[model samples]
Target chain A: TQLLEQSPQFLSIQEGENLTVYCNSSSVFSSLQWYRQEPGEGPVLLVTVVTGGEVKKLKRLTFQFGDARKDSSLHITAAQTGDTGLYLCAGERAGGFKTIFGAGTRLFVKA
Target chain B: SAVISQKPSRDICQRGTSLTIQCQVDSQVTMMFWYRQQPGQSLTLIATANQGSEATYESGFVIDKFPISRPNLTFSTLTVSNMSPEDSSIYLCSVHGGQGNTGELFFGEGSRLTVL
Candidate 1:
């Protein structure tokens, strides 16, 4: 079975602080996606990285797919109270329709 | 992107009872997915519902405990039978964004179930 391990299960930071969450796995994936979920809501897609070493930015968030497609990272710059949520990374294996998700990183940004 | 609506946004059920969550998509989709999530945790795919066919459940999940029905392209239902305290979790329904194999998924707000 393929599993994605996420680091820093919980994080609490003050406003304007920078934080990085990492997702690692031993198996390669065809594509990786990052999602943010707020309380009482389902996850929303932040970005999708399909190529190795790909980097995509969405405002204050930067997502990176590793060169081997076995890992990914999300970096938040100057995080604010609005950035507090659960961040999840999901990967799709080659030739498979199943998407495996990481345990998730709960980020709390205080204003 | 697809819009999904789930019924019974939140419910409180007693042990040994059953609850069925309904999902409706605005647009027709070939496949709809059911996921289970504990509070503050990531999603776990329970099964994949396809119209006119039996649902495909993931490992560790059985059809007997969670029966799924996809009568058409735009609707599906998942029933949690003989519920227990451990069955308390949020159930989400989702569909692909029509971007092919590696496309993103759009999910409903989810049905939060609390079993006593």
Candidate 2:
């Protein structure tokens, strides 16, 4: 079974602080996606990185895929309270349309 | 990405009773998936609902415990049979992974179930 492990399962920071979360896996993937989910809501797509060593930015958020396609990272700049949510990293496997998700890093940005 | 609308946005069911959640897509989707996220846990794929075939369940998930129906394209249903308190969780439906992509799952608002 393929698994993606996310670190810093929980995080709390003050407004304006910057933070980074990571997702690592031993298996290779064709694509990787980042999602942010609020309480009682399904995850919303943040960004998708396809190429190895690729980077994609969405406003204040930046996503990077590992050169080997076995890892990824997400960085948030000027983090605000509105950025508080569960950040999930998912990998799309080869020939498999299913998206496997990481355990998620819960972010709580205080005002 | 596809827009998926799931029904029974929130439900409070009694133990031993069952709840059936519905998911509908705006267009014919090439893929449909069901996922469950227990409290504080990651999203876990419960099954893959195809347009014409029986749903394919992931490991640790069985048809009897979580029966699913996909009568045609753009529609699917998942039934939590003989529910229990531990079965309470958020259920989400997704489809149309991505454009010329291997994976991209657009999700619904999610059905929140609370079994008491």
Index of the highest-lDDT prediction: 1
Per-residue C-alpha lDDT of model 1 across residues A1-111, encoded as one tens digit per residue: 329999888999999999999999998889999999998998999999999999999999999999999999999999999999999999887778888899999999998
Q: Interface-residue RMSD per candidate?
A: 1.0, 1.1
Q: lDDT tens string, model 1, B1-116? A: 88999998999999999999999999999999999998777899999999999999998999999999999999999999999999999999999877563658889999999999
Error of 1 at B45 (Å): 0.8
Candidate 2 structure quality by residue, lDDT tens digits, B1-106: 6788999999999999989999999888756899999988889999999878888999999999999999888899999999999999999998856567557778
**Which pairs clash (backbone N, Cα, C closer than 3 Å) in model 1?**
none
Evaluate candidate 1 and give its CAPRI docking class based on DockQ: high
Candidate 2 docking class:
high
* Model 1 alpha-carbon miss at residue B102, Å: 1.7
Number of the top-ranking candidate, with TM-score as the measure:
1
